[model samples]
Target: MEYIDPHLHMVSRTTDDYETLARMGCVAISEPAFWAGFDRGSVESFRDYFRQLTDFEPKRAAQYGISHYTWLCINAKEAENVTLSREVIAMIPEFLDAKNVLGIGEIGLNKNTRNEATIFLEHLDLAVKYNQQILIHTPHLEDKYQGTRMILDMLMGDSRINRSRVLVDHVEEHTIEHVLENGFWAGMTLYPVSKCTPQRAVDMIERYGPERLMANSAGDWGPSKPTAIPDLIMEMKKRGHSKELIRRVVYENPKTFFSQSKPFVHG
Candidate 1:
């Protein structure tokens, strides 16, 4: 079945990876700005990167019939550099009108530091001002629970944020309940190493019933499988899930959530 991988770093993947995604039924993807494996020294580095996201990557994905969309923000790892993070957040608006641009995101705490929360709220301010849909990256492993709580608290404190337009991604069993119960969408990142596995993702779907949930490969520079969403489909089928139910999680859920963005015109 055709699907959308809502979170992946295509810039870190090869053209062959894109072809494989096409063959595996990935019709579109949304790439969020993330750490480049290092701290960038200046805002100019981010400007160039945003240009690549809004310009280069989409054309590259089109070669294999995959629509590309992007979200812009200095990730939490870099957000500790408050001065630099503010500069990057200020510069993000220049690219907001790009046809493939989605919103300010994958923006949440990494170490759950004070600086990270400050920058996260600032990015939230930017998104609310622009009326952009949000895509959040919750903390990993041990930090996931508290960081998600902090994020939800921050989001709740801001009355301007529309809960339904935001997606808190990388949710596991411990964190998914708060995300969905509070009226925000959740994403299960299917990875071979960390985050949810394909089977665990299917488990969440069974338990939660796939109302406001979706799955992603989160393919990046690390050890992650780009076609993990298809694995989720196979797992759901293996457990005797109806194709409609499987498609609702992998394809329709993301498409519905992302449709809230004006630049995401792909159906």
Candidate 2:
């Protein structure tokens, strides 16, 4: 049962993650540009970060038979500084043309502030201009509900963009319905502490019926588990989910989403 983790920060992961994922049947991943595990001082910082995604990480994944692709963009938490965010967004197109580059992503509201909203709109515009699929990271905890609503409203208001071309990520029980109902691709992060657990992800799939939706580990520079994706797959199988349904949710959905970008190649 091969899988595609559509949203992870593999740049922050260890080689062991690659090895484990390959052994667990992860064949490909789309690592999105995130907050660098901290705030960066300048655009040069982001420049170097993006290089690691396009250059270093792919080499690491290749050694373990996991094809690595990246979604390049400034993270919403860091996008509050408009100047730096703009600079990073400008640099994204150059990388978007790279071989393993997939799309512009993980770029929605963080704290749900005015600045975050402004940057998110800019990201949406850039994605539309580049004809790239957009991957959004909604806020977490108490902010999750409001942020998800705002992100959906803005996407709806933007007539130039297509909801189907966007993946609204990090959804929970509270946010998943709006995301699915709005005709957007839904992504549930399989994290132990901060996001959906593997069991909950399976429950959501059962309830939602796996249409235009996918799940990822979102493993990154925190106390996050990299094995969450494979765990979800295992649990889903154990629960007697049909192979076709499991394949569509865990493998085919991400492939179809990232396939919108010509640079992405699935083995």
Candidate 3:
């Protein structure tokens, strides 16, 4: 079935990967800015990276007939540098008008530090100011719960934030309930090594029942699978789930959430 992988870092993948994704039924994808293997040295580095995301990556994806949308932010791991973070934030406006640009996101706590929180709030303000939708990244491993909570509290505190316009991603069994209970959309990132697996993602879908929930490959540089969403589709099939239910989770849910964006024009 055709699907959308809502979150994947194509920058880290080969052009052959794009061909594989297209062949596997991935018609569209959204790439959020994240850590680039290491801390970048300056705002100029981020400037070049954003150019790559906003300019180059879209063209690359187009070669395979995939629609590429993107979110811009100095991801949490780099948010520790308040001065540099602010500079990147200020510079992001230069690319907001790009046809493929989505919004400010994958912006949430990493280690849940004070600086990260400060930067997170600032990114929120940027999104609100621009009337843009948001995509968040909750911390992983043992830090996931508290970091997710902290991110939620900050978002809830802001009256300007329309919860439906935000998607808190990387949710597991423990954190998915909180994200959905609070009225925001949730994304389960299917990974080969870490995060949740295809079977466990199906378990969450069974429990959650697919209203404001979706899944993604989150394919990136690490030990991840670009075709992980297809793995999820296979799992749902193995469990005797209907095609309607599978389509809602893998395709419609992301289309609905991304419909709020200025640049998301997928058919």
| TM-score, candidate number 2 | 0.97
- Residue-level lDDT of model 1, residues 57-83, one tens digit each, is 999999999999999999999999999
Residue 168 lDDT in model 1?
A: 96
lDDT of each: 0.93, 0.89, 0.94
Clashes of each: 0, 1, 0
Could you tell me every candidate's TM-score relative to the true structure? Answer: 0.99, 0.97, 0.99
**lDDT of candidate 2 over 1-267, digit per residue (tens):** 899999888888889889999998899999888887678999899888888999999999999999999888889999889999998888777787788887787888888999999999998889889888888899999999999999999999999988878889999999999999989999999987779998999999989888998999999988888878878878988999888988998899998888877887795
lDDT of 3 by residue, 1-267 (tens): 999999999999999999999999999999999999999999999999999998999999999999999999999999999999999999999989989988888899999999999999999999999898999999999999999999999999999999999999999999999999999999999986559999999999999899999998888889999999999999999999999999999899999999888688998
Q: Candidate 3 has which clashing residue pairs, if any?
A: none
Off by over 4 Å in 3: none
Error of 3 at 98 (Å): 0.6
Error of 3 at 144 (Å): 0.2
Off by over 4 Å in 1: none
- What lDDT would candidate 3 get against the real structure? 0.94
Which residue pairs show backbone clashes in model 2? 106-135
For candidate 2, the lDDT comes to 0.89
